[model samples]
Target: MQVNATPNRRLVVGISGASGVAYGIRLLQVLRQIEVESHLVMSKSAQVTLAHESSYSVADVKALASVSYANTDIGAAISSGSFPALGMVVAPCSIRTLSEVATGVTSSLLSRAADVTLKERRRLVLMVRETPLHLGHIRSMASATEAGAIIYPPVPAFYANPQTIEEMIDHSIGRVLDLFGLETSLVRRWGT
Candidate 1:
C-alpha cells in the first residue's frame, strides 16, 4: 500500500454532520491502503451522524486515520496556515460546514483548517452531502470556488455501474483523490 506521492505527504480529512459518514470513513481506509498519512478531525455533530448511520465507534473511526485531532482543537497544527499538508477534504460536508468555510468563519478546527488550506493555496475539496440545495448553498459554492476550493457533491455516477454503497463511495472518493493528483484504481473510469 505504498503511496505514489512523497513518503510524508499529508492529507487532512474533516467529517461534518452530513448523512454520508461512510464516505469519510472509506476515504480514510483508502488513504491508509495507499500509505498516505491522514490527519482526521470530526465535528461533534459528525459523531452523532456516525452513530446513527453506522455501528462503528468514534475510536474505530479515529483508528482509520494515521492521526486524529479534536474538532475543537483550534490550536492543532492542521488549523494553522503553516501546516505543510498537501490538501484537505471535507467528506460528507454538511451545508453548515460548507457555509462556514465559504464565509471564512472558523468557529471550529475543521472550518479553520479548511480556511488555512485555502489561504495557503492548497487543495480543499468539499464533498457536499446535502440535497435540494437552495440559493444560499449555490452562493456558498460559488464563493468557495472563487477562493480555489472544489465543491464535489456525492452524486452517483451511472457510468461506474455501482452495485453497492461501497462501490459508490469508492468511486466518489477516488475521483476526489484524482483532484489531489493521487493515482488510484479504486473505481473504473469512463472510456478507460
Candidate 2:
C-alpha cells in the first residue's frame, strides 16, 4: 500500500471497555479543538462502558471525530498501514485490548488498527487503565512495549494541583498527546 506523500494532521483513536471512558472522550474533544482530524473506533464493550461512565451516547461520542468506524469493520481506513496518521491511541485501554495489541492477534478494528500502527513503525500509545496487576498483565505490558507500543498508564500528576476530576483527566490526556508532540493548553506544566 502506498502512503500518501502528503502529511496529515490526523490520528486514529480507539476506545475500549475501560473504566475511564472520559479520557477517550476528552481526547477527541481536544483533538477537535486543536484542529486535528481524528479517526475514531470503539469496541462494542466500550459502548456499554460509555453509557455507564458518561452522559454521552455512542452517536454523541462519534460526533467528536472526523471519521468514526465500527469495531467489526476490519476494512476501515485505519485498519490499513497506508492510512496517514500520527498513529493510534487506545484511551482507557482495557486489559483485553492491550493483550491483543501485544500478541498482534487483533479481534477488532481497535486492536487491529493499533497493530497496524506498530507494524508501520508509528507511535501507538495505550492508556492502559487497570490496577492490582498480575504477572500476566505485566507480561502483556512488556510485550506491548517491546513491540513499539507506548504503555502509558494514566497515572495523574498531582503537581498540577488539579481541583476537579475533569482537570485531572485533561492533564493526563494532554500528556498522552504529548507523546505525539501535539501539545495542548489542557496541561499545566510545573512552575510554568
Candidate 3:
C-alpha cells in the first residue's frame, strides 16, 4: 500500500475494555485542545468499563474526538496502512486487544488499526492498564514491542506531585502524546 505522501495532523485513539477509560477520554480532550485531529474507536467491552468508571455516556466520550469509528468497522479509513496518521494510541488497552495486535490476528477495527499503524511504521502506543499481570501478558507485551508497538503502562509519576486524579491522568497522557511529538502544558516538567 502506498502511504499518503502528505503529512497530516491526525492521531488514532483506541479505548479498550480496561480499568482506565479516563486515560482515553483525557487523551481526546487534550488532542482537541492541541488542535490535532483525533480518530476514535472504542471496543464493545469499553462501554461496560466506561459505565463503571465514569458517568460520561459513550456518546459524550465520542463527541470529544474529531471522528469516531465502530469497533466492527474493519474497512474504516484508519484500518488502511495508506491512511495518513501520526499513529495510534490504545489507551487502557485490554489484554485481549494487546494479544491480537501482538499476533497480527486482529478481530476488531481497534486492533486492525493498530496493526496498520505498525505496518506503516507509525507509532503504536499501547497503554496497557492491567495489574498483577501473568506470564502470558508479559510475553504478549514483549511480542508487541518486537512488532514495533510501544507497550506503555500508565504508571503515574509521583515526582509531579499531583493534587488531583485529573492531574495525574493528564500527566500520564501528556507523556504518551509526547511519543507523537505533541507537547502540551498538561505535563509538569521536572526541575522546571
Candidate 4:
C-alpha cells in the first residue's frame, strides 16, 4: 500500500487495549481502500488483545496501515502537531487510554499523539469499548469531550439492519470517518 499521503488525506490511528481490535483493523483497511494515509500506533496491550479477539497477527494488522509507529516511540512523526494529519482516531479505546487522554497525562505515544491532535485543534475520535458505566468512566468521557475529543462508543446501529458483525463494525467506523469528512460506502444509510 502507498505510504505517501496528500496534504489533506492523512489520518492518525491509535489502537488501545480494548476488546474490539477488529474496529481498528477494519478502519486501517478502509483507509487504504479510500486512499487515505493511515499512521497506526498500536499499544503493546492492543497486540495482546488482538491475539485474543481476532485472527490477524500484529504484523498482519500493521501491514494494513500506510505507516506504523511503536507505542513507545514518543518521537514518532505523528506525535507532533506538524505531522499535518486531518485528525486522529483511537479505535476500541480502553478506559485507561481514555483516562490518559482526558487527564492529558499521555505516558505513551498513542495518547501523546491524541494530545497533539487535540492541541492542534484537530478531530480526535475515541471509540470507547466498555460497558457498565461507572461515574469515573462518565467523568473521563466528559473530560475528554471538554478537551475537544469526541467520545464515540462503538454502538451497533440496529436501524441499519446489519446482517453480520463485520457490517456492524463497518457502520461504526464509517460514522467515525465521517467526522473527518471521509466518506465510505460501508454505511447503510437509513433512507435512500
Best model number under lDDT: 4
- Which candidate wins on TM-score? 4
Q: Write the per-residue lDDT of candidate 3 for residues 2-42, one digit (tens) a residue.
A: 22323457899999999999999999999888888889999
Q: Residue 16: error of model 1 in Å?
A: 0.4
Q: Runs in model 2 with CA error above 4 Å?
A: 1-8
Give lDDT: candidate 3, residue 67.
Answer: 86
Better of 3 and 4 by lDDT: 4
lDDT of 2 by residue, 1-192 (tens): 122323457889999999999999999999888888888999999999999989999999999988899999999989999888889899989999999999999899999999999999999999999998999999999999999999989898999998999999999999998888898998898899
The global Cα lDDT (0 to 1) of model 4 is 0.93
Candidate 1, 1-192: lDDT as tens digits: 332345246899999999999999999999888878899999999999999999999999998988899998989988887778788999989999999989998799999999999999999999998879899999999999999899999898989899998888899999999998788888798899
The residue pairs found clashing in candidate 1 are none
lDDT at 33, model 3: 84
Clashes of each: 0, 0, 0, 0
Model 1 TM-score? 0.95
TM-score of 2: 0.96
lDDT of 4 by residue, 45-143 (tens): 999999999999999999998889999999999989888989999998999999999999999999999999999999999999999989999999999
* lDDT, each prediction: 0.90, 0.92, 0.92, 0.93
- Candidate 1 segments whose C-alpha is farther than 4 A from its true place: 1-8
Model 1 lDDT on a 0 to 1 scale:
0.90
> How far is 84's C-alpha from truth in model 2 (Å)?
0.9
